[model samples]
Target: MNIPLNRHSPTPIYLQIRNYLSRLIQSGKMLSGQKLPSIRVLSTSIQVNKLTVIEAYSLLEADGLIHARQGSGYFVNPKTTVTSGLTLRSNFSPSQEVIISQGGGSFFEQYTTSIQARRQQNIIEFSSGFPSTSISDNLQRVAKRALAKAGDTLFREDFPQGQLLLRQLIAQMLIQQGLEVSSEEIIITSGSQQALSLAMQYYLRKDDWVIVETPTYHGALGILKNLQAKVIGIPMTAEGINLELLEQYLKSHRPKLIYTISTLHNPTGITTSLAHRQALITLARQYECFILEDNAYEGLKFQPVPPPIKALDRYDLVTYISTFSKTLMPGLRIGYMVVTGEHHQPLVKQKLLNDLHVSTVSQVIVSEFLASGHYRRHLNRLRISNLQSRNVMLQALESYFPDAIAWTIPKGGLFLWTHLPNHLPIQTICSEALSHNVLIASGAAFFLGQGYPAMRLNFCHTPEDIEHGIKIIGRLIKNYLTPSFISVGLSSQEVSVSSMR
Candidate 1:
């Protein structure tokens, strides 16, 4: 029980004690079911107050590392998993520590859980990352037909590279969009998130530099965080990521990869141009860095756009990823990535290690959907419906929101990135909106530092829900702007709600 205590350190004494014991227990130095010293004995031995020792023990107990019995002293929890080691060893160097709000879980996980919790509640949910469109009957019939066709094959394990049929269909679909990719170059993943995770895991080492768009997909940020990569957020422009600033970063920092969502980008519906895509590939070649292009929302575009960055890549510098989750249905969990050149086989191996490929049933169904042309028909209907939903949300924002707020009008996509005056309490507005049963994503989770004064609103809700949710959010923002609204510390009810619909 030899513990070193740094009295001069900024960390509190109790936390230090807890952390020390946690490391010991997790490292298996202190075996499960081992009894800890009595609080009085440890306090006297360590020359700390008994209360401090009690607090340390209490914290450990809270974390399920230790438990107490009525007659016995605390014993290590037998089922405690070795998670403390993972928490302590971070990718961040002392100088490059990311100060974003990664307090509990990453925002992506938190928002996903939040969406799930609020599913049955009579609430206007703008927090969802998935599209709000319902599954078409055509898709159901396609699924049934797929089952009939697949029969016993669905019970068998497919190749780690994915079912050849689905990959071929995806490749054909991409070729129509002007990207020349072979089925062998593609690896199926659980979703684009899995593809993103695989690429990051494959290319990144701790403290290895990786660049992403500021206010980018929080899920990607979460993956980068887990990998302990040094993330550099390049500011995004209306046309896409700022290439000039990106080149500056590439010149100074030799990042292993640059991640971007070039078309119908999440949270902001901005799409990159053909010239921008070409120039980006050129920059990647010059910098000797790879590009991870997340084209998840490409199929949901309201209008025609440039081919993917991978299409413009002549040097095999780009690894492109997309998913049926966004276009068809998230439950499908079918996504694939195209890796050309030397990285393809390695990534195929990585995919083999990543859940042994996506679900066989999902792949078969999606393949059938694609083969029957139902996916294209579904996308056409979804694009139109999504556009109308976006229009409804925009109209609601314009009609009810305060003049201090501004938002983007995405041509296609599920989100509307709304910026408030920096002085406004963005977090407070979000909380109040939630109190009124309106869920919105805080902009802070998307950045490297204290996030911007902005929020991401999903337009995938029904037109009625969109209008109602925006009206409520608009009113909340208006309350913040009022000169007479001085009760920042007051409860949610006191802030404003008498006029809420």
Candidate 2:
């Protein structure tokens, strides 16, 4: 194969190679089953590294554009048959549903009841990013104490920012994390979700450009879209967001804000390294753009937590947002934001008008929880359980799934992101899994408009549940990929039997 390489293109050389080969296959120049050169041969021919060739081949294989034979060579997919020398019909269809069940909007409001209707149902749910129930008891005990001390004053209109006690606790925590924020800098909100919403309301305007990670938290994407913000998505890699591309986008478009989940990121579960964090902060400062840091999962790390981007932010360009939703309890609806720079007071006033302050009772309850040192101990226990669950899930995936399904080995977070064969639609798989009394989130929910085929699995369940659920999901995926299964319709018994294996 004669392939020209571009040295000037900002895109990675491996991706360029992948794209070139993909075009060839799509154009029918490379027929199905045609053997390609080995990775070493390709690397030598292209004057690139062998690892680059390997990466290109892996990407092609993941996309089902090509297949690999052990100890042989890569080839166009042999099973991708053409009829009468015409192109094979597309097996995938775009999703037409206006809204997804587990996605943005109030779909949860209506579906939450129906989903919980089957209290006896033993299905392991990976839909919501729920923290374990073990942490809830600690919050509950603290709440009871708060209630007893309130004596009716807690319900009255209190400090607009939040209870001073809660703010002080948040400040202390930030100081421990190496951030120079004080109690006055912290503004409490109903939840991190609310904090994000408030940030969007305060900063973004109609048609303002906002930068986000390609597959980001669905809730944040939804809010940005609803705000009519012109959103640009930067692809995420194992290291972090592509900082080079981010710099390019910043130089060109000059977006209003860059919203990111830097620590224990959602869905993908990749943490941004300190080097990348500094680079991003520098880029944001250079571009005169603001950084909205969503550190919602900061405490869920099984490993030592990486310092947040805010810690490295010296110019006050970063607006740090986090919550106790994952660490303590979601129902408390307690979260806070540290907004620096000149715009802080105006943002606070908007927040006051938006909700007239978060519930004082909840803030006091959380404050007491943090003050008693119970929250840290509870987090330690939760981390241990979460780590065990994550390990078990990793083992199950490795044992049962094919190598074609790639995933990130997250350091710490509730979810693991799995990239399925691009040809297989994750939404279809999710629908099929639902029929088997198993539920997994479709990867499409994370994208802004059109999304790639992927899924996020939460490893916050019991080991048995994790094992059983992975087995079912893995088998379902295998059946979906089977040539015979695709040609003929799948049966309930066949699916169940495969799941049992």
**Reference-based TM-score of each model:** 0.75, 0.73
Model 1, stretches more than 4 Å misplaced?
A: 1-105, 482-501
lDDT of 1 by residue, 321-398 (tens): 999888887888998999999999999888888687678889999999887756665676576567667777777776
Model 2 alpha-carbon drift over 4 Å, by segment: 1-121, 134-139, 482-501
What is residue 437's positional error in candidate 1, in angstroms? Answer: 1.2
Task: Return model 2's CA RMSD, one decimal.
Answer: 18.6
The alpha-carbon deviation from the true structure for residue 34 of candidate 2, after best TM-score superposition, in angstroms, is 63
lDDT value, residue 285 of candidate 2:
89
Tens-digit lDDT track for model 2 on 314-350? 8888899999988887778999999887868887898
Clashing pairs in 2: 190-333
TM-score of model 1 vs. true structure? 0.75
Q: List the global CA lDDT of all models.
A: 0.76, 0.74
Please give the RMSD to the true structure for each candidate, in Å: 27.4, 18.6
Clashes of each: 0, 1
For model 2, the local distance difference test gives 0.74
Query: 476 in model 1: Cα distance from truth in Å?
Result: 0.6
